[model samples]
Target: MFDDTFCLNVRFLLNTQFKMIELPDNIAALQSYKPGKAVEDIFEGKNFDRTAILSSNENNLGTSPKAVAAIQEAATNSYLYPDPSGMKLRQKLAAKHNTTIDKIIIGNGSDGILSNIFKAFFRPGDELVSSAGSFVAVNVMTKLNNIPYKQAPLTKEYAFDLEAILDLVGPRTKAVYLCNPNNPTGAMISNRALKAFIEKIPEHILIIVDEAYAEFAASLSSEFPDATQIELPNVITLRTFSKAFGLAGVRLGYGVGSQFIVDTLMKVKLTFNPSIIAQAAGGAALDDAAFMQETIEMNKKGLAYYYKNFSQMQLNYVPSFGNFVMLDMSTEERAMYVFNQLLNRGVFVRPLAFFQLPHCLRITVGLPEECQLLVEKMAEVMTLEKN
Candidate 1:
């Protein structure tokens, strides 16, 4: 019984209003974070071993036995809201780092800390500086906030170009971000270099040292910088439980900084972050020293294994301080070829295109047998590619 002309006019007016709703440029420009291909997406129900997922640099050995118990115990308390301040976890972190509780800030993960970092310190005109191929989260955060940046290229050896980054610092540079033992590439800045870099940074500008892989580097090398020891008012060191602690599932991380920065971040951070389960897991995991030591040793051995095998194969790779090694397959085409080939054989390794290293692939160290399986399958892919 509705009139066709009336319905058409109403529809036309509605469509016009919907079409006029434009997204802000900053939001519109964002490229969604697309991580490496998932095993399920690649296989699509094909019969394959599900355990060969080495793409994300996740735990090779299992979660800590103690943390597992803690997680179960905490789950039963799901009816309760988490402590809004996350004081308990922050207290443990403070004690471990020889800092007061006021100096630590907990988050859902280091990424959460980063989100707060931008919110607390950055302004419209502030320019952040870092290397081009560092963590992509910086890209997303900066662009989302409409913040401009200055970028230096990584050194030929695939390390942060400290001097170049320092050179980029100027009046407009309000912050500098460094990812030590950087993602995908896995090279670390030495303690001496880090010190020199920090000393030169103007006190007015903040320095964010993202040590997501610090545990692995410290275990393997004597000279790795302990950013926590710097004690500079402008310096904030970020770390996570996800990597070396094997609690990636729980998503707990924190930042160590001056009381002022900590207080500022707390104001911006979400209240009740890192729910009850995460806090319990992190606290219990910290007590399991044996488990952490075993993880560090395994990562050390795994990196060495990768170095020896990659050398034997005559493949060019960056020496990695982190758990994963980056392979330069010489071209993006070849990297994609090997990546697809590995997936077909039930192996999933990371292709670094999104990390701006299109010709490179990052392979995490698996168990000894899984490592062997990958090498064997890689050899097959190499032969097939040659043909």
Candidate 2:
């Protein structure tokens, strides 16, 4: 009996190797999107004398004074839960846009709202359609839900090829995604083009237009699409406080759509989708139109500063409507090398490999001095490369 027991134990021990199972198929198969490197990560073993992070396309103008004051006033009430309905902020948003409160639905960020939308609308066999080289989060969310995704290639000028995207849609297509003044490239769809495109799409398939960078574009051009113009039942427009409002850390974003779409999103959104502090800050930011205008003016000046430097360096870049611009590197390796060099120097700019444009880097428009410093550092790097 002892011998038999020993043999059984040995067999059980040996079986450990065979019992190692494969990882779950869902998350394992999904592509992970690389976000901007945190400022803390650049410190290494010792703190740098000067460090600035412009990688994430964040508002360079610091958070609004009014919003900061609002946060301070609300600090004592942190123990209490935020209102789940977000009624106050929704009402304010509606008043600003000349719409009803029920038409707005707030979320943790636009990304959260998007994920919830995918979960609420998509099924295992449904197909997701989006422009190639757009935001990586959309692709990740689609795969997480086991939805098949189809990429509609952009035009040579990096504009949304609406016709190409429409051609890809069929019975299985559930949603279409767009990042107007699109990330990395900063190309935008004209208002007329977008309106015509939406008119062609069926009511059942959703058209998600991400206007995260819309405020910056609003100041620069009037040709971009506005939510008020899109009256289609299929259209949903997204905006965020993380951009022009200088509240990236606060995580406030909202979706404006038909009442049916807003209701559908609320069904999947968590209780207290936005924190009280975030709501307060967002509302205050909206009230501070002067701050927003100053930010817009600074961005325009900074953009010009960078373009002048680009001209002198003879570096090619995509003309931008957003707060950032993409410079093309002859090879992906060179772009990555410049990214690493800048990070070591305590300036962080984003590499574009995550967005599938491996030979480019996206640099946010910072303060005038910051822009000058970035140009000086880039010039130094380029000179070194030639030697």
Candidate 3:
């Protein structure tokens, strides 16, 4: 009996030991991406009656009425599984872009599509080259997947250094990511510069142009290149309903690329990645051209308000093509101090330390009232700092 009991105990110990698992070194070493703080979380216990969430560059004008109706209609059919292929949404997206459905790929969001691209095209040691201080997702995903990443510094005016980025592209570089109307700093590359840069890139390396803020950029500048209009074999343009469509909560986005690249990305994408409701909402949003125009107009007005105020105050800010502007505080400490003060005043703006622009704070263009409040709070904060 004693021998049998000891043998069972030994087996249990061996099984437990075998079950212990270690994550890959790359994943184990990764620092997770931090999204903008939620309004509720930030304002908890604060006595402020009003809050302007200007941290995330969301469409404050709200979701399209048509999208809302579509989402409501789709709710009743939630019992059925979503179409894994996302055919209908792809059809709508293709029609909108004047392309075939075969060249379109949809995912949970642009971020998910980006992940699939990284997984499908890159190997463990392959490199991704992108602008320094651009979107954080590319950096996060590369580190998480054990892929090497190289960053080319932004120009002195906070625009993409296209020549520097081209210099960084080497033989093992699998992809180049260009976040047009770049985040944190809403600076953009003109059509001429972008076209030249694309032409100079090697055919083997894929160019992934992330145009999350493309609509706003296009409205602000006639020179902004619409990647969809560019017929490069190596280029993939990513767009999302999260911005202008105001469907961020719906989590729908797509990639337009060559048939070959789309096919490969489909293999890595999660089945039924975007739900039926998200698909329906995206289709409806595309049709709601009036809502999109209204959102753009509101953003333009808000940006104009900010420009006037910043100019009057003599505070330096990037002339933004996107819906957000970055204010330079002259020092990281000052930026942090202003961020905290703004938070206390019930205003939320993004601090840029994480993006390595330590002395800057990114403020999304909010509603007219919110924009006024943001400017007022900034003025107050600067005054307090001066004292």
Candidate 3, residues 1-387: lDDT per residue as tens digits? 669888779889878554458888888788665797566488887888778899889998888999999999999999989999999999988998999998999999999999888889887678999888888777788887788889999999998999999999998899999999899799998999999999999888999999999999999999999898777678899998899889999899999988888999999888878999999999999999999999999999999999999988888999998889999889999889999999899999999876889999999998888898999998998788778
Clashing pairs in 1: none
Candidate 1 local distance difference test against the native: 0.88
The CA-based lDDT of model 2 is what? 0.85
Residues 1-387, model 1: lDDT tens digits:
579988778889888543467889999888776797555476667787543778888777879999999999999998999998888888899999998998898899898899889888987799999998888889888988888978999999888999999899988898999998899799999999999888888889999999998899898788899797779899999999988999887889999999888989989888778899999999999999999898888888778887887887788999988888999999999899889999889888999887888999999987777787888888788778777
Candidate 1 has what TM-score?
0.93
Candidate 1 colliding pairs, count: 0
* Between candidates 1 and 3, the lDDT winner: 3
The C-alpha stretches of model 2 lying farther than 4 A from their native spots are 1-23, 31-37, 44-49
Q: List the residue pairs that clash in candidate 2.
A: none
Q: Which residues of candidate 3, in runs, are more than 4 Å off?
A: 1-20, 32-37
State the weakest 10-residue window (summed lDDT) of model 3: 31-40
